[model samples]
Target: MPEQKAADATPRRLPPGGGHRGGGWMNAGMPAERSMNFGPSARRLLGRLRPQRLHLVAVITLAVVSVALSVIGPKILGHATDIIFTGVIGRQLPAGSTAEQAVEGARAAGNDNFADMLARMDVVPGTGIDVAALARVLLLALALFLVASLLLWWQGWLLTGVVQRTVRRLRADVEDKINRLPLPYFDRQPRGELLSRVTNDIDNISQTLQQTLSQLLTSLLTVLGVVVMMFVISPLLAWVALVAVPLSVVVTQQIAKRSQRQFIAQWTHTGELNAQIEEAFTGHELVKVFGRQREVEAAFHAKNEELFRASYGAQFISGIIMPAMMFIGNLSYVVIAVVGGLRVASGTMSLGDVQAFIQYSRQFTQPLTQVAAMANLLQSGVASAERVFAVLDADEQTPDPAEPARVTRPRGRVAFEHVSFRYAPDTPLIEDLSLVAEPGHTVAIVGPTGAGKTTLVNLIMRFYELDAGRITLDGVDVTTLRRDDLRGRVGMVLQDTWLFNGTIRENIAYGRPDATEEEIMAATRATFVDRFVRSLPDGYDTVIDAEGSNVSAGEKQLITIARAFLAEPSLLILDEATSSVDTRTEVLLQRAMAALRSDRTSFVIAHRLSTIRDADLILMMEQGRIVEQGSHRDLLAARGAYHRLYQAQFSQPVADDATLEPASVAT
Candidate 1:
């Protein structure tokens, strides 16, 4: 269903109070406090690339050559300029005289090699113009340019595959980590924020690998190569250019340091914004019903504004690198020009040599400016990588015991022996709780909100480890069994129905992927889902949208019931499974549940007293302990909490075997 249409179609009968206001979206995946170690995080990130060491070496080699060509091209062009200058100056000599005569006349006392002496002569045909030599030099420069371009392309092509493979492995590791995480981890995190880590943060790392890595390498290489070339041309001009290097470094470091916090803040705020949007849209029904549209909008606007401020601050601070470096570079250039002009006038350095030194000086400063500009980008990429690594570094759930036991065909006898648990260390919710349910018995757990009804079920399923004692299933300690084996034998139909985007048949058969079509049809028919399935045009093939929004809440609940039924587990848990259905559907559902629970051990957590009045054992809980426990008649005779609860829910004592049905009660 389109989001707009679904938002507009509010349920005709919303529960008296809105259902859970804080849902999957309310939790931001990231922590509020920001802390990171840039050096360690960068090292760890680079370590992931170790598998691509060969590819990295090749890329670095190519980058060095590319930068070397760029540095050499300018010096060669300067040589051409020198040749033209000498040709013009030599015009004062005889028409065919070359600069070789002047070099020979000014020969030093040291012996010169034959090749060196030959190179001193201009090989061009004319004395005033070396057209052929200039053309040859230009042609060499063009060839270098073309070769560098090809090397750059080849480097990029190789690195792209390597980077993609690395990211792919990282993404897979993250996915595996998520699966191994304890339920409490998810409880403490926001769904959207976690999603941001998996997507936004990882994507940022990919982009940095694709673009920034090559550029950064090339820039650093260019800077080093240019510095060396500058010194060769004229150490005086080289020193002048080096003066700007430290200044640029100081400027870049200062600005980047200031921008780091903003970059972290920007990403953090982005996570908050994504979480808010996810929550608002997921619970749009509650917002519309309670007229909380303005409140949601205001909350979103606040987060968006915070993100905007952080993003702007990060950009503005990092942006200072380029212009500041350029200004310093330009100042150094002017200094070199003044010094080199005096040397040329005094004939200590020829005009051609001075011109070549100027070219080398420009090349020296260009890469410094580029490096400054890239500092911010590299910092941001590191921040993103740090977040991705955090997920990989998270503590995982305890592994199953060595030589774990497997339940072949569970008899469903469960015993909670002196079990103690609490969500937090300071707040004890369940203490020394003991309970037993034999095979084929119905154990009804009824309690007020926060009275540990769901906690009891969670313990039985081993979704959490007990603080002090053991929970046993069929006389086997649950802790000794693999979690997958333990949960596989226990089926649950929760209050909140969850159905992914798929055909109705797929949703119903989720619990047993290899279930035959006949079994699926039979389970759906038993749960009364077949009645509604036939009404739809596509029947079992109809697609259910995300959250099963295309279907009504009651329909969604029934489908989940069918899923549990199809699994045919030895133990069944219905945690307000009938809460969403209408009174009529609930009655039929109860009948179906009765048949489904006939031979299996069942735990029913509900607020409606009528539904559980006939349970084999009823546990009326207050806080974390069971205050009352007995058969319905025995409990009423005691006139205790269960009796009081039953009296409050009905007009009179319910003695009828079949006529004591009541609607869903808010817990």
Candidate 2:
């Protein structure tokens, strides 16, 4: 009953030779090649944000204001210095004061006692300090500091909305894409890589986008404004600060290239690690059965180490970015301080001008630091963008003709002509196989494994395009008909019946939601699922967890059949319909199948000959070609491939028929 503990606690038994090796992987040393193909997906990635432009506007405004506040805060401090300090110049306060004495004298003139005294005293224009003016300037500086604080908070608040909404929408788009994509896309992609794009990449982008976009834009504005202000104060000092720009750009470009390459590898290795973990846990039964615990752990360790190396390498290169910008920024400040000091000492510049130059130099460097950090985020985001778009670029399974003339319902008569397919150019999996299932009849296909049996169904379902063939329903070419229309008509009961984690009623209702509860009960009763399900405390309302692990394989199979019965399609394709069930249950399923197929056309691929013993036609196939065709009794009498296979499957003298008679076996 507890398959997890029962399976894990025991030793693992792998299938011989090709299962798990000493390290739990048959090909443990498979070369690690995690290459990404990056191209013009940047524009496309930006378009993914179309729905959230309003949030972008709000975020950008905050960014601009926040940068202005921070950049001007120091500049205001510099201005305050000029207003408060009176230097020794040719212009002096009417000779009642020294340069230091003039500043002290002005401070006393600012207030009630001071202003009245200053107004009463004799002070000349351009040579005197006004204490009242200095106080007013200091008040303005205080207001600038307060504004800067508010801007930072505003930036944070605006960014929160952008990050949460954009990330939610982006995740939703990926999820929607997953549902829209044809099944074949999943066949080629590792689940781990796809998962990494959704979880890790999107999460990184959300955290970085609102903040980094703000930082980068604000930094650019600050740098430009400061550079202009620097020239206003002194062109020579501004030039010294500008010297690092070209070098920083070139170095950052190099870092972007290296980090991009490493990030691609990092995500790939992360995917491989996840894939290994999923495979290890899912097939843990196999691992433990063969006593492969040590080997499994060791394989996992190897994958983890590879991921660590790749991630460490990527972050290490990206990490250099901050220090590089800071190095240039610090040097720029020293140059400004030295040059401005020299100019002021030589009397070529006023003390106020020198102070302004230092302020502008800082303004130039701070934004540059912010921009450099933003560049790092940009590189990683771009890498993820490329990966996500790669998925979008892969050709979807083209739906059959769009806007085609409608056929309200399909009368299932399927024909395959000269059908051939090869997944790769050289490895032919299906050959020129011709087949037909007439309306209102069941055609059974039985052959050895890899005889193109499932491939036939896949082609019928249009999971993959055929290399050369024409498959038709009734008189219409299937490719010319809409895919959904065709799928809607055909009912499939896969070899592995998957029941999602929902109520038994919900699972059955998937095929037709409009079907009433009474219809669902009727379908279940028709398939005999009602027998076992009713035995439980809850009948149709009982929940099935993770493919109905609580129910036996036979019960799950019957529930799936009930779903098919509810769809009530004109055709049913059953692949290994009875393999997982016991002999008695198979008899029960066969009884249900008789009523299901009485009026509909059915194509069956079966290994259990008993279920298909009375089919109107049976096709015997080998190596992608059907070698025999006839009714079951007629084929058994012919002594050909069908005869041999039928005998081979049931050679044990029926294992005593009375015990296996299965009361009320229909047909």
Candidate 3:
């Protein structure tokens, strides 16, 4: 019925230990941690990059070219070292001595092992260091490195654009999806939880892509290139260096497996904590009025503690990956160093070849280490992605008709034919009830809480689809008509007044954006908003805060009424529209509404029976059925359900000839 009034009239308290489920107060639609599907979620996240495939390909190409250049530099430096070593050995021998003479001289001098080492070297006894060749090789290596660095920079630039564009598209999709979702979807989801998905989770996804995409690509390619180069120099050393690969894999898999659950839990707790904070702040005054500040603080602390535990566990477990990988890499390095040194001493492998192989071994392990380090970010990103994807994948409201019916001249003749609806399968809120509001009639629905008053108006607006019968507006089924078209013809003023962060003038003109200043002022005067506006320093330009806390509740209600008046719609729905206003202001509002409702059908759902006494038709509802329907006078004369309600409400007997006027009721 009057949803806001019903909710505010009765508040439900959480039972003791109620919110500790799954380690936090889980939202209705939130998936359980154990149910998270990492693989499918990750794949779907990757699919968002499909639109940026061309840019990704270019990034991959740049990475490959740059890494190839980087991998070849070490071998070139080794060759330069060989040239210097040869020249240094030549300088130690006698001038003009031949290579054979040097070896024999070394053997004759009781250095036979040295002679053997010299035999393997391309040393000239008479020559000095080849400075020219060394310079050329070093310069070549420098040039290659410089080019590789430039390519990497360009790749990073391209990758950044790709990531930002992808995130932008994702944000647009989420916005569109929210607009398409049914009202019940929001009823199930907490505002803060949804905000977390839209803002925080999306931001996390962006950061993860920026950090991991380029680095992961370069690391993978570097590993491959380095492995090939290592084999080219010495297959034996290559095999020895690869001994760490399997071990690194094991460590990463084990840590990631454990850390992934923690990451999911961390984000889940984050959302829950956000919801609690939003609720506490929004209702801070109420909490104080009820002396529940301590309880609120206690709930906040519990949620915050859950978040801390989840975050600490995730970080602690994932942090072990890098150190473990480094240890494995170091072990491989030691083995490669000893084997390469032994090969060099035996003269089977040149010193330069061993040097190049050692460099290659380090290069191979470095990328492996980088990959291990990124495991934490990858896991966290996937967890956030799953949350976002869940929203994207939720069931949307039924689509509007393909060929919508139009009311060229709407007379606001709304009729419900055997309409039935239920929020749940077992609990019927409205059933097989029918009613009609003729053109230019003011229909007032009066009832206690949960009497289907607001629900009837909601049905005419097509907020919820009927389970059986259909509602028609001007002989056209509301479902067949486009929602925008139907709503455009109707103006609504809810008990809960909503004003955006804007000027008073702007808020009043929200429904009629193209209305002139003269028209806006007229509306404000009609609804008594102009009376207060003239007293404010800024007058019509006075700004309202996001929560409209800057204005009094009565003034806020007046502004909303003025907004509805400005629309000049074919039909009007006022659900406790004057509930917030004082008696004087409400009397003024009644006059304004009388003027606005002229020649237009109006539906007014009110608990204050005095406001609707003059309504042409009054429907008294109870338990989803209309117990009585007639003019206020006729219903009182019958002394039935409506008479009993009136007597109970006023708590007094009234003379049959006396009229119950607004002014008298206010007194």
Best by lDDT: 3
List the global CA lDDT of all models: 0.79, 0.70, 0.83
TM-score of 3: 0.93
| Candidate ordering by TM-score (highest first) | 3, 1, 2
State the displacement of the C-alpha of residue 254, model 2, in Å, after optimal TM-score superposition.
3.5
Alpha carbon lDDT at 114, candidate 2: 38
Per-residue C-alpha lDDT of model 2 across residues 85-194, encoded as one tens digit per residue = 44223144556454445445666665343333333333443464566776777787778778867876786777677667777877887787776687545644445556
TM-score of each: 0.88, 0.83, 0.93
After the best TM-score superposition of candidate 1, give how far the Cα of residue 13 lies from its true spot, in angstroms: 34
lDDT of 3 at 410: 80
- Cα lDDT tens digits for candidate 3, 1-667: 2334333222223222222222223332234355367788888898999999999999999999999999999999999888988898888888888899899998899987678778889898878889999999999999999999999999999999999999999999999999888865665566677788899999999999999988889999999999898888888888888888998998899999999999988888787777777777877898899998887788787777778888999999999999999999889988988998887776677788888887888888888888888888888999999888878999998899999889877899999899888756667778888889998999999866767787778778777678989998999989998889999999999988889999999999998899999999888888888998999999999999999999999899999999999999999999889999899878878988998898899999887889999899999877677778999999999987677667656866556624543322332
For model 1, what is the alpha-carbon lDDT of residue 261? 88
In model 3, pairs of residues that clash are: none
RMSD of each: 6.9, 8.1, 4.5
Clashing pairs in model 1, backbone N/Cα/C closer than 3 A: 27-190
Better of 2 and 3 by TM-score: 3
lDDT of 1 by residue, 222-280 (tens): 78898888888788778888988888888888898899888887877776676678778
The CA lDDT at 506 in model 1 is 95
Tell me the deviation in Å of residue 150 in model 3.
Answer: 1.2
